[model samples]
Target: METAARTDEEWQEILRSVRRVHFVGIGGSGMSPLAEILHSRGYRLTGSDVNPSDNVDRMTGLGIPVSMRQAADNVGDAELVVYTSAVNPQNPELEEARRRGIPLIERGKLLGLISRHYSNAVGVAGTHGKTTTTSMISQILLEAGQDPTIFIGGRLPLINANGRAGSSDTFICEACEFQDHYLSMTPAVSVILNVDADHLDYFGTLENVVASFHAFAGLASRAVIVNHDDANARRAAEGIPPERLIWYGTGAGLVWSARGCRLEDGSCGAYDLYHNGEFFTSVKLGVPGAHNISNSMAAAAAAHLCGADARQIADGLRDFRGAGRRFEFLGTFGGVTVADDYAHHPTEITATLAAAKGMG
Candidate 1:
């Protein structure tokens, strides 16, 4: 997707000129948060979703008019039309907006515009763990009294919502790499968890995926935090200078490293965190899985760079139960335990099952 090429002043002017914004496919996870952010910013918002969802109900409860059906008339008096990638090309409401000459922007582009309003826009990008890691960072910042603006892909239990309009200059969100969507935002801190060969339908090859991540990292104006243990993440950070690059993993000589790692009950992990080879703090994760140890380290690195102390990081990680669907415990039936997780990729599935096996 091609984003609008405009300066910060130009985007600000565009936002000022518009009052009423309409969203297509508003119930989507990505679309709902953007709508909520705009609504909180005092923009008159309306939306249409093909199916009723919890998100639709939430938007209606906020007094935003949402139509259950899509029609040309649904674009009534909208000054700007925002559509997600999932919207059909021939949708009536979109066609009506185009016919009426209303300015249109993709959801990612609008997010980019919103990101510019923050001094510290931390974008978490990776093939997996984006939601979980983003939630962890949000928890840390919020617990530290930073009051950061958050836009996670899943529901964060700390705020009891997927997005929050905060009073601080920090904006944290998931920077998705599909179709180069992440290139739209300018992040002060870019956290690349790990790169993997997914999204082949859009990227066509693993090398292309790595290249896209490299470009995304270059967009970070201040710092780039990456996983040193992942080979692909290392490749993505190859050209970055030492001063601007921050490495986190389980090894010596790293800016942020974990040591004395031990797992409890084969799921949860406790580790001693180190910064510049000095003991920073001891962290005990409330969330299950050894993979989450790595996720917590990445989150801790981001929170520390953003002005959080070691105590705040440890407390935040200890308080986080988990994201909405990343290894959620459903219930036990007939002496058999059941749980749910959103692990689709092979790598994610492997990690999730390993944690489950440990619990058993």
Candidate 2:
């Protein structure tokens, strides 16, 4: 299992040992975020993509070298190489890395270390809403004056920055459940918004997938906030040392839940929060979708558990509109509607389409 925070010694060792590192798929969403974070940390970074992309351009602007094509020579001067799962073992660049005996790290491990550095490392794991939920949480933290170093799977509009290196002890991150990637982080608090079988290519069955969420929930030393409404989420988080379990539902007795939920102007989500059955406060989200109301509850609960005041939570939620590629309106071709989202899996597809249903 992954721990959210790493010791100073561990980080120092990584810094001292890894002088130069290269990324195999630089344009990838996950890879680009980590590359930028490492570049900010002052590691000599070089990466390659199959073609030019906004990610490649952004990396170059950060003083890191990027290439449109992958060459064996790209790994020449680098002492270590990192590659995503998409890169087959037989790939030319990966072959070179092995031949050179350069320490090869999987994409998951690289993201794990970055997650460990944050004082508040949150892994939002579920079959759906990981990206949107992470972005919503990030927006709330941003509004509350948390200079959090946040990394979301998609682009968030509020920050106008994909990843920010903040001075505060708070660090907000999106922990991916694909291939059980969330297993790498040790979060102070872990949020299980909901759970269902996903990434069929990785986990053979839904049972195995639920077990993974259970394992992740157990990693939360402080608390595990779960969607009480989601039987699967509750079941997956069953044995979470009673005290470590915090439940949230739709206006139930859970610690956090949405009350009076509604969409505003068909562009944003609005809802009132009730804490343990009492009218807590109201929030006007800058993003669309009714699902975000529940997503915001989970984030607010996690933030509150991490010591963020209610005002901070409200401010962060208000300021955060949405992330990039998450139902992002490209341009309307007539009234049919054209939007882009970073939902690659069937589960993601279902959730997004469901959100879209309210439109008609």
Candidate 3:
């Protein structure tokens, strides 16, 4: 598959035009990354969050001005404003941005625009496994010496480092389907790790979850990988052209399959992988779980499709420790490892428990 470049002249103009920007609700998971990206790109960034968090602390430390309150005064000197969906239109800063006629874009659109700038951008989308899958892909990219910019909804452990300055065109990020932001990404190679019923607050129903993924998969100009093991995922890929869809699962029609896997006896467990009906390699994942095994396959399929070598892919997968708040071992307090995961949804809870049981 050919690499995707931003063809939209308007998007290019936005990136070019953003010099100093103000963020409303800047401490959020989504907003922090946008702030980081813009700041890294030399944008004079100012932001306000209702409360202070580590993310906000990090931004201010980077020299971006931050306000503790969402005052309209925060937007006074800004030429542009960025807001997350969580930022209500009633937000004083947001309203001020509107009154000043400054450009206001959603956090999702900014992230999408950031993704388009990378040549090997892989957007991992699913109702679950997004952070884990993204971390899996990032580990692979890093182990192989591929300097890819990385971002996940949860912080990853292997990267020990949160994000990096990539030397290559590759950038990997989790494309959350909530509020239909996953559709904003221009993915050259995308991975739909799984499709489950989630985000009922926005998507409303299981059918809507599948529908959003369908719309997202349709946005893929190159390859869209799906999980053959997931029925919803299979349905999601139904409309995608056969050539554009890559499936991964147990001995199946998918491009890649785990075939059979047993956790290796080590600090980070391992698995044997298969690609295109052939034994590919013994992939020692830096993370654990049957779900992660599947994520590894998806990452490999996307990386392979995007021109990364098998050896590099294997290294990246091996180096990925785990994502932040994702089964993270918060030091054994009393001979018991308390694993913390940011999983709140039903499916996520099940997977987290399963991963913990597997470790035990």
Candidate 4:
């Protein structure tokens, strides 16, 4: 059987083939979003994970059955099975699916398949800031009233979850690079936020990581949006033609650049946005950090490429309050504002700390 469906009708037929879907490791962040999306799409979803998690409870509340332990019995009546990358072949549910000859789909491949159903699929990818940038893009699209279906790596306040099912044909998602999973996606527009020396455990080297990113960009059917300041990101997008490539940065010779960027209210940033050496708009970020400004630029560029106007871009960035755990402010007490962030990389930490230090 052909795994990929080239047309929406073909994709619909593929989905119609499976009535009951089973997911292994359904409690995971990556798996949970897909489960939610599939469930919302009218699939009879059943899942099993190693242990119970908040995600399991969430899925259960959604009326999807969730088993606490993974077992072959959990695949009961499932016509199709989906598994995360972390799942091993020895997993009883997976083994059962194979034994029963049920069609199996991996998480990334499933995302790709779902993307094909949409007329416009925007994939945000990078070594870091994938979550933040994806959230930003989602916000811009939402603010523009585009009604984009979004699958973000982080929980966005606007959606109150990691995924939002929209009626429009536009779909936005974070394209993860770990294990080269992003290469599976079929995006109309792809954004490469930045490429750095990370995820070495999987790719083994920066060169391999760049190659993977290049392949990701090559998958874009419409346009590839890349960061002009990041050499690695620029290099990876070299295969795309100049017309197909849209560059955004804070340096000379770029398509989009920020001018007069400065910290505002001790945390946020105020900047003048430029597109192709012409003043586009003045953007004042709701979230802090120059890094966020860059993220907003990328989001703006993507939304613009997809037809969002300047006002929508400005309003979107202004409305965005930042994703969960990324510079998330807990509360303020005794003249001290408590905040939490999930920055792991050194550059991420630096940006987060810099924003925190400037907070009033």
Candidate 5:
């Protein structure tokens, strides 16, 4: 029989054995947070990015040396190398690391390693709303005095950064599904906001996408929280033991559900939250859009699983103005209110535009 793969604890122990670590393309949203975590752990770190960015400046401020170029020399004297998927396979530093036989791992794998350290790791995964839901969970956890270690894809105003190194055992992160990156994580609670056809370039078919999500759900050690209204999400979570699956949606008979939804100025929403067919709390969200109501429901469920009470969930959702770039409001110019959003996918664009149109 073949030897079993190393457990997360084993991988974490192995990571602890290294001192000097090098990161290629470290300024990326995903890479920077992992770097922050490792640096907090006292690992001497060096990194290189092709372009200057706020993330790069942040790393430099933390006393982590970051090179502006990607030459092989930048990999000097590192015991281990970590690179993002965005980095080219032929990048000089990566080539040098391989040539020198330095142990190498991808950014997602590093995130997985870090997550294993937390007893309550909440991995928020889905085709949409990952960032928003993750931010909401972070807000609730923080408000509840959890002080979770959060790694969101977008900047969270609560922390004034995209990531933070918290002293608590709770770890909250946006678990991206692109290229099956989330498969590497073993979450204590895996929250699936929804499932849809996305990243077709990597996953050739919607079926394959669902399959990948199913695989990710299987990695959850405690529970899988899913969107009950989404058929694809329901399908993705089909085989999970009933006791291990928690469903949240607008519909009735869900473990977590929302009712009496009312929108303020056709944007922000207020709803009565129900848990197990009983009233949990009344949630008034700071963020706009009907979609956000669903996102909040999911966030609420995840937070509850992580020990947040009803009051914390409601207050947290109420305090979240929105993650950076998800329907962000820019200052009005010439009486035309300006706004920015990171909505590329058709589904996301539709929801964003609908929210904007509703504002009028």
Candidate 6:
């Protein structure tokens, strides 16, 4: 029987046993953040990805060896091997690890194990806005002097990278639902921005998706922040206590709500933020988009629950322009506005297009 670490102390023992760690499919968005965090912690890290990306180069520049080709030689005396769900079963590195009886852990389990070290672990979960909302929360914590360790799915401009290793015990990261990855996390504060039908290929049905979100909410130890406008989100958060739940939306009534939109000139979205029927403050987002208003409200609600003042929430969001490749403006060509984005999912694409329409 193979034993796995169940607690932070147990995981620490596992870490001490290994001198170097190898990651398969390391260039991936999900795997790269963990690699960066581990690298910053004085671990000898080696990785291999089937495809090459700018992130691969970034990791190499950080003194972590990365190989574009996957082979058995890449494992190279690694004590522990971590592989993403995307890695092929026939991959030579994986086969070598199995043959050598090296302990192999999946990506989600590694993330959950790592999160246990933080006193305040905020897992931002949603079908659509996990990256955006995670970035917003990171910015808020930064402004409030929390010095949080951030691991976002997309590149955040505020952090100047997709992830950062902070000295503080506050860890903020995106909890993805695909393959029920969020199930591994036990967060101090869990923010459910919204729940929509997605990743059907893995989840099989919409009911399973709702159940997964509910499970994720139940794992929150401190507070559960959700979008009141989304019914799926409300149902999913039913596992948590009523008093522990903090609702944020553009709805008529909620714990945190944004009202009085000022999107006339596409400069910035100005709104009066309300908390429990009382005016909190006037907030102006540096980023443009009506969806961003809701995202900001969610971030502010989580930040406030975590002891951030109104000023920190406002200023943090004000400084957050946007994430890299998230509706990023490229130079125009021949009187045509050119922009680049990583919105591949249909729902994300729809939201991105809607935001683009609101710009003019």
Candidate 3: global Cα-lDDT? Answer: 0.76
Top candidate (lDDT):
1
**Residue-wise C-alpha lDDT for candidate 5, range 1-360, written one tens digit per residue:** 000244656657669798999989888888888999989889999999988988899999999999998899999999888887778888898889879878778888788878888989999999999999999999998888877888999988888778988898889989999988888887999999888899999999999999999999998989999999899999999899998999999898999999998888548989999999999999999988889999999999999988899998999999998888988877789988688899999999999998888777
Q: Which scores higher on lDDT, 2 or 5?
A: 5
Number of the candidate with higher TM-score, 2 or 3? 2
- Candidate 1 structure lDDT: 0.90
**Which candidate do you rate higher for lDDT, 5 or 6?**
5
lDDT of 6 at 281: 86
Q: Is candidate 4 or candidate 6 better by lDDT?
A: 4
lDDT of 1 by residue, 1-360 (tens): 122655657656878899999999888889888998899889999999989987788899889999999999999999888998888878998889878888778898889888988889999999889999999999999988888888988888777778878888899899999888898888999999999999999999999999999999999999999999899999999899889999999989999999988788537989999999999999999888889999999999999988999999999999998888888777899997777798999999999998888787
RMSD of each: 1.8, 3.6, 4.4, 3.1, 2.6, 2.4
Candidate 6's residue-wise lDDT over 32-137, tens digit each?
A: 8899888878889999987888678778888888988889999997988888777787889988988998878788888988888788898899887788778888
The sequence of per-residue lDDT tens digits that candidate 2 reaches over residues 1-360 is: 112244535644755688798999987877887887777777898998897877777788888888778888888698767788888777788888778766677778777766767766777776777777777777777666667777777777775556666666666677778877878787878888887777767888888888989999988767888988888898898878887888887846677778777877664678888887777778888667777777888888877765677777888888775678888877777678777887777767776787677655
Using Cα atoms with residue i matched to residue i, what is each candidate's TM-score against the true structure? 0.96, 0.89, 0.89, 0.91, 0.95, 0.92
Candidate 3: deviation at residue 322, Å? 1.1
Better of 1 and 3 by TM-score: 1
Q: Point out the worst 10-residue segment of candidate 4 by lDDT.
A: 1-10
> Which lDDT tens digits does candidate 4 get at residues 39-85?
87888999888787667887898998888888889999988888877
Error of 6 at 133 (Å): 1.0
> What lDDT does candidate 5 reach at residue 241?
90
lDDT of 5: 0.89
lDDT of 3 by residue, 175-220 (tens): 9988888777888777888888787888889998998888888887
